[model samples]
Target: MDIKPLLLASGMIAATALAGCSTVGGSVYTASYASITDAGYKLPAIPVSKVPEQYRRQIVSYETKEKPGTVIVDTTSKFLYFVMPEGKAMRYGIGVGKEGFEWSGTARVAMKREWPVWTPPAPMIRRRPELAVYRGGMQPGLQNPLGARALYLYKGGRDTGYRLHGTPEWWSIGKAMSSGCIRLLNQDIMDLYDRVEVGAKVIVK
Candidate 1:
């Protein structure tokens, strides 16, 4: 009956029920999500028990007409799928735009960066003045919102100012919390950064 749809509509209940729905072997998930040393920072390992099974990265049967290497972000479901051959995909949990910031559209990965600098957009700075200090851009580091990797999104060669990036706030997954960009676990994003190339298609829905 697709109860997950209804559960997702109720955040509190969904958190409990979804956590009980499915699970993975500790060894496998633990290994895949182990701490990483990137650009001189030690990314901590994820606490597998705190991550719901549905949100963990895994391969699943995905029926999509999109070609392999395409990226699809289902914001409502907090999932990002990387399409693969044979109607399959590597799905990762994501944090989407919160409230008024929600957005949807198709774009192309215009660029990819590791430990990228972060500069809050003008509007965002106007809303949160403290970010104004970063008008010149925040240096990349563990505390950077872009985390370990970032894939800049553009449409028709115009920068959309959106990105598929990593976040240190791992607990934000499966929730709507970002300003507009899609965020994944640092571990997951580092892995994805290696797989996706600049110019790949990205569909946000």
Candidate 2:
């Protein structure tokens, strides 16, 4: 089977939804085209009770300050820390950038979106023409590139366009992967999203 047609079909679905009349939808459809919604896509839920008991507390260690409400991600260790003030951190497993995209820096959460529209950067589209379907912003939905939720980053008040977000691909955790975003499991990100607000400090190193 030729992979090109398969990829092209996926691109068409993404492109069509993005180009469709922009309006909020009342019903949720699991079909790929039905992914986008009014507020944003509702990320699929995986009951925490069902999560493997063994995987619940997967810890990647680092000695960062435990300042209340601050979040830290150590790419080297694939750990995300939610500072808990009393010299302890609540850590979660994460997926970092694919080798060449790995970066270290400090930034702040400039904004947060429940489900964000995604527009491929010129380089990203150039690298994958299939992404050209989204020359305009992709609609917010399960199919959207930003995934379940997006925490936009900023440095000195400028949009960095990089995000810390969730992915449907749960297996990607702890692995290095393409692009400049940080990927978390949907369950983990939903937990983190509930705890963070705009203006939170984010340290990625």
Candidate 3:
């Protein structure tokens, strides 16, 4: 007539089930931490702390027809998912373009750079004449708008004039800012830059 053993077994089963659900739903998470020293300036590793919990990098269970290694960006949600096998993805928070600068299309990563120089396109300078000083090109440094890395996007062997790049402005994640290019926290973009290869598929929608 002892019921304690049965109750204990049921509790164990329930706990196990909860753990599995958490893993499948991609609720368990951790933040990235790394010291970034570049261009004579050491950037303190605080991006993880600055970001919201929902925007932190984590493995997520994503349902998509796209193949693994593909980068799918959901601007509406300000999330970028790097597709993986078994319906999983490494998702990160992103800063998308504002209303008029928004763009959606498929492209491939044509190039990758570390501490890339920033050249304000003529049009961009025209919009803000103060940027004229950098008209030739801004040297790569911590203060450069491109931040620590850049992934140039191209379509059909043509430059899209858009990029998936890093920003020192970690606070901008999960917002509609930027001219048109997709932006990520410096630490997050560094992680993404390592995983993504040139010629990888990218879908922004």
lDDT of each: 0.86, 0.70, 0.85
**Model 3 Cα shift for residue 170 (angstroms):** 0.8
Can you list the residue pairs that collide in candidate 1?
none
Please list all clashing residue pairs in model 2, or write none if there are none. 98-177
lDDT per residue as tens, model 3, 1-205: 9999999979866764543322445354444445757656676676454567778777888999999989999999999999989889988889999889999999999999998999988889989999999988899877789988999999999999999998888889999989999998888888899999999999999
Best lDDT goes to which candidate?
Answer: 1
lDDT of 2 at 68: 72
Comparing 1 with 3 on lDDT, the higher-scoring candidate is 1
* Tens-digit lDDT string for candidate 2 (1-205): 7899999978866774543322213321121212323354455544434443322333323355546778888888787887764455556677888978888788899888877778888898899999899989888666565677779999999988689997777667778984978888766676678778789999898
Clashes of each: 0, 1, 0
Q: Lowest summed-lDDT stretch of 10 residues in model 1?
A: 22-31
On residues 1-205, what C-alpha lDDT tens digit does candidate 1 reach at each position? 8999777658745553533332323211222676778778999988867988788887777899899999999998899999988877788999999999999989999999999999999999999999999999999998899999999999999999899999999999999888999999998898788889889999999
Instruction: Decide which is better by TM-score, 2 or 3.
Output: 3
TM-score (all chains, Cα) for each model: 0.85, 0.71, 0.83
* Whole-model alpha-carbon lDDT for candidate 3: 0.85
What is the total number of backbone clashes in candidate 2?
1
For candidate 2, what is the lDDT? 0.70
